[model samples]
Target: MAYKITSQCISCKLCLSVCPTGAIKVVDGNHWIDSELCTNCDGSIHTVPQCKAGCPTADGCVKQPSDYWEGWFANYNRVLAKLTNKQDYWENWRNTYSQKFSEKLQKHQGQVPA
Candidate 1:
């Protein structure tokens, strides 16, 4: 399976330059991996996935099926809060975003469009 960029990405764009297939793209304020083009760095220039290696965040790039987007976002926010000394700000944002996400999930009955 291809690797996916989590919400932990931070939109640093470091992965873009490292990706051999040009699969990573910035969309809607986040950096996303194009699954079709992603090769998990297999049979490419790198032995390890470049995105994962290039990413500064813990678990920023991970195997798709195993990476839960919501959890990743929460973890990312937590780490960001600590790093930036903005715990309160990040916590507030996380709470608001989580609430909105939950509401949307409920409205969709847990079926999110891929």
Candidate 2:
């Protein structure tokens, strides 16, 4: 199974560099995981999925949930576009971007994506 990056992400590129499958990517100025290319580090040298191991947030990177689907990408894109400005988004990242992203996803999808 593949892993996912959640709104808890702080834009740190740690996950990007550690993913053995190169599944992590920057999309519309935010990090994303390409499930097709993800390996969950099952066969890789790392005992754990590197992305999760490297991520700083408590739950920023995690195994993809059953509810995750294609439509969520559009929701993610729409939400990210509104939250991508560094000055406005990152200055208070922990409380601002992550919280707003969760609130927006709950509003748009009727639940948080992750």
Instruction: Please tell me which predicted candidate would have the highest TM-score against the true structure.
Output: 2
lDDT of 2 by residue, 27-109 (tens): 88799999999989988899989999889896688777556675477568656776784555676877887889988887988
lDDT of 2 at 33: 95
Which candidate has the top score in lDDT?
1
Q: Please, what is the TM-score per model? A: 0.56, 0.57
What pairs collide in candidate 2? Answer: none
Query: What RMSD value applies to candidate 1?
Result: 14.0
**Error of model 1, residue 77, in angstroms:** 19
**Residue 66 of model 1, lDDT score:** 44
Task: Give the Cα lDDT of each candidate.
Answer: 0.84, 0.82
Q: Per-residue lDDT for 1-114 in model 1, tens only? A: 788887667888899999999999987878888999998999986889999988899777876764588658866876776768864786898999999999998989867776
